[model samples]
Target chain A: MTDELRSRMVELLPRLRRFAVALTGDLDQGDDLVQETCMRALSRVDQWQPGTRLDSWMYRIAQNLWLDRMRAKKVRGVQVDVEAAEALAGPNGRRVVESRLTLDAVGAAMAYLPEDQRVLISLVCIDGLSYKEAAEVTQTPIGTVMSRLARARRELHARLEGHTREAIPRQQAPKPGRNT
Target chain B: MSDTPDEKTPAQPIGDDLIMPYADGVLAPDQRPAVREALARDPELMQRFEGFLFTRGPLARAFDAVLAAPIPERLLEAVRGPTPQRTRPTVSLLGSVRLARLAEMFRVPDFSPAVAVPAVLVGLAAGWLAHYAIGIAVPVDSRGVVDTASLQRALEVTPTGGSAKIARGLSLAPRFTFATDQQVWCRQYALIYGDGLEAGGMACRAPDGVWQVLMSTPPVPGVRAQGPRPAGEGPGGNTPPNNENVLDGVRSLFKQGDVLGREKEADVIKDRWKTP
Candidate 1:
């Protein structure tokens, strides 16, 4: 990797880690996502332009990696190591458990949203992407991004308030729901 | 979280629906003056506005720990391996400024107490702690009891003297902090001057991260209650008024040196609220 690319990657680990956590729901998966994104970025160096928003590119990669992981998870049972998550949490596992409760409430709330809404929020709401940048990353219209974001926020508010109930899942799914 | 609306102009009356746009920063610049004006006088609307702000930040706060965590060795090796083998520069992944900003994002849950503090308490209403039939600064439910939610919110999130006019327009001042026998952090505070009520209490952060009001008393009557004694007071007020009746039947706990400075208390709170 070039020196400039290496420096930017270092600078973006925090942002990338943040996006991964939001996308993957916890730090264990988030770590995998960041690692995968970095590996992909470094291996396919020519795919990125020098002066572009490298953070957004990395975010898109992490999102794509997370999506791929969710697909693969369908073949096998969902496995999130409880002890590993706790260990990752250090003295506190906000990154691993993320929620004060047994699971991550923000992720649980985000699971109530459609994929597009989740992507919109991960981009614009948490990652500080502009409307245009979010639209570009998600490849959606700006108006759609804005409206979907509103709906997502509204649904999230409701779910967070326990006003919305998650559909009982027959089998494990990636979308956040009652784990047990 | 910033509760105040646009600072460009004062608040003006506006529809509740306008709160999202204002909070999302998409509100038209010209339209902000009226919305800003409205959010000021309307505590209810102001709270709703703050709710919108809270929604925007939960994801960040939820995963904030990742920002501070050392990257997995696999990822670091992945980066180092790709580059020509040179000594890697020890660049802090997140600068101190960014780290502090990330830490600052942890806010007490707004709008949803149950969602915010999900462990060990169901909304932590503390209906059982309603024995103190004393005057209160914050409004009370029908039982004439002070609900712990509003007071706990003030204790958990708002810094000393920095509360917005929330829930009953009461001005709460965090007086001191200590750890319970269970190692749960607790804070002592005064109701100060709100709704003609003068009271003080200790709130401990239960394992679930909710501040449980341990004791609520209206300061000793005739013994001359000591005001908040910061470090300079020399611990003269260490002994809470030596009046039995003032204890209000609530056991007085916490030894001296138990209380801490407002800044230290905030640090403990941040630690208690640490991610995971």
Candidate 2:
């Protein structure tokens, strides 16, 4: 192929890293994910049939890697409320310091999701892959993909709503120090 | 709302397939209104979708950070092989290595202003000499005029293939002529001399306008040939023994007024010899 693929890698690296961060939820782990992705890409250079979308191929590789790591760990981590994180993150870090704080919060929230949900969310929501492309990467049926997506959405909604409810005053609860 | 402690909304609930795509703004424009309507009625649902999108943005940013992280020095050194002793270093690492080396080179034992000045001067002289030598050895000009006088003027000289039409004196009179050795001529200032089947000589023109031979090969081969000898040898004065003999014959002929030389000189003097 032309230097196009190699040059495209430089442009893709940051985006790939973002995918990795979403997948792994820790900066260092995300870096490892990126490294693994690059190394795998290099070693299996032959598998990449040219003319196909490179970003999709790379996202698949990252998601696959995340899945493999989770399977090996066999430890399920608690999923964070994405809305709670966004309320703190505020879209993106337009201001340098604010951005980093937001990034950290986002990272924490991403780490909170179950591995499958996190991967699917990053692929479809973050990287903007279509369900068909995500199915192709995840090696699942489109229907199964849809079902996992539904469960992930409901779970995220409950977690966010729960945090919002906890933040505001509840009519049922009285002041702890005062006797009614 | 009271009966649904464990029940979800009956609307099949927007799956990640729909919600995620909607969050990315990748949903078809016509389909966005439907999703927006769903979001409007459900604050909890809207919040979840926003969270999905906002977290996605930072996750993307973190990836950039990882990629932008400075690569370790060891990795760079590994990429560019170690420099061998006594061989010139190929600092193929980053573009910054050369500047570092230059800074290091500037530091010397007992470094002084006097030492540095003389060292720089000697380096310049050596560089000029090397360049001059290479230029003479392989002069690369292709536009040099094919004339004995112009050849003499050239710092480097080579042979041209066609007829050598050398302009002489002030009126640019045509003088001696010869077919070329090769099909190339150059205008570059370099000493180009070659003698094989044809014995070439480097000719330098004197201040007095007479062409003098700086170097030449003998006309007679080492082994004496039995028949007829050569064209410029015994009886018929067609070609001279070498370029020197040609110049000498031309000068003598000018002195004797047998061929035009002084007439050309007089015109040159009149045209160019202004006192002030």
Candidate 3:
């Protein structure tokens, strides 16, 4: 009800949208999901105890709402809501070289992961949450988050490089010769 | 470990578990330097780290662009709706409890006719405090003080009827903030509900931040036409204009400047008064 909380929520939208985009795998539905999450948060502003992390709470809400939609879609026999998947804006060259990986390849590879694994990857790898924080967001134990994130990163890497995950060893394997 | 078998590292080999966190920079601070040293020594480990970084870096960066993109207006409207394209946003989708809270915070209802009104007057006239339906008898000394502790705490934290949490579950909210010509900081606060009307009072902060009681409204309407007694006879002059039951003769002794906004009030409470 107060502007302090409401304004903080407004500032968190872009980042929230990013997480949503990653979770839903489509830009448009993710935006819709973000909108729904914001509405729910605003209506229940009292539920958030003052002085806590707004972003984490928002991430939790977005995650829950996304999972709920996934369940409902399954019940209704629905597949990917591809209509809203139009890429928002393509990669910009201005970013530092390290972050220049294209969304198309990553997005395609990410599609292979289950919903939970994708969420773990989004939180830790994409959004930069620590395992403890990601666990808090995903409502899992730290050990589970760590293992899942490791597996997810490995799976995503293998998927992107056109190799089976078993072909990659944990220790010193022949390095891929990509010039990046 | 990778099975290249051609090269072996001198240091303890990094495990599958340690590789990602090291690349992600989430390894404990003490562990990072050793891991970094090993990463430098082992090209395969470095490659693995690079692979992990590649997985994270571009996706994170691509999403960072989305972070810069305009948050759709629909989302902003949900947070605070009816916003002007430029300045103040319009009132938003307020919940019923919050709406009630806002109402309670703005107005306090007092119904202690016995303590608020003269005993002889209570006998002679059934005033609005009595008529409003609240009858809690507070011990008001000659200074017109009732529930001083509740009054003081209400002044400090529970500024609104809905938001304030005071002793005994009674709620109070600040309605107006004004500085008297004497530079004394003062505000009007109300009892959440007694009988059916809100009983509000004005208090000025003493030099020590203690709020010295100035005056209180008997749970009567601020509007004049609804006055329970005639203009000359009833407590007149200071009845809030909106309450129809308050008489015209009941006046407040505290001379005040223009009422301040919520932020201005917060500033005054923090002893940072600036003229509007």
Interface RMSD of each: 11.6, 17.5, 10.3
Best by TM-score: 3
> lDDT tens string, model 2, A1-180?
323344344336656766787677666677687777766775676899887878888888887787777665554542343443444333352212243434465454444456677777777656667778888887778767756755554444333334442332222221111001
DockQ of all candidate complexes = 0.17, 0.09, 0.25
Q: What lDDT is reached at residue B195 by model 2?
A: 21
Candidate 1, after superposition: displacement of residue B45 in Å?
A: 8.1
lDDT score for residue A127 of model 2: 69
lDDT of 3 by residue, B1-276 (tens): 554322344454575467788787767676666677877888877767766886777557756545544455566566656434312110111223433443343343352222323321122122322331121123221223334333444565433212452323334556555555556556555544423344555455543333444335545423333323211132347544333122111113333545555555556545433322
**How well does candidate 1 score on lDDT at residue A170?**
19
True contacts kept of 3: 0.65
Pairwise lDDT winner, candidates 1 and 3: 3
State which docking tier applies to candidate 3. acceptable
Q: State how far residue B91 of model 1 sits from its true place (Å).
A: 17
TM-score of chain B of each: 0.39, 0.26, 0.35
Measured with DockQ on alpha carbons, how good is candidate 2? 0.09
Error of 1 at B142 (Å): 56
Give the residue spans of candidate 3 off by over 4 A.
Answer: A78-99, A161-180, B1-13, B33-44, B84-276
Candidate 2 or 3, higher lDDT?
3
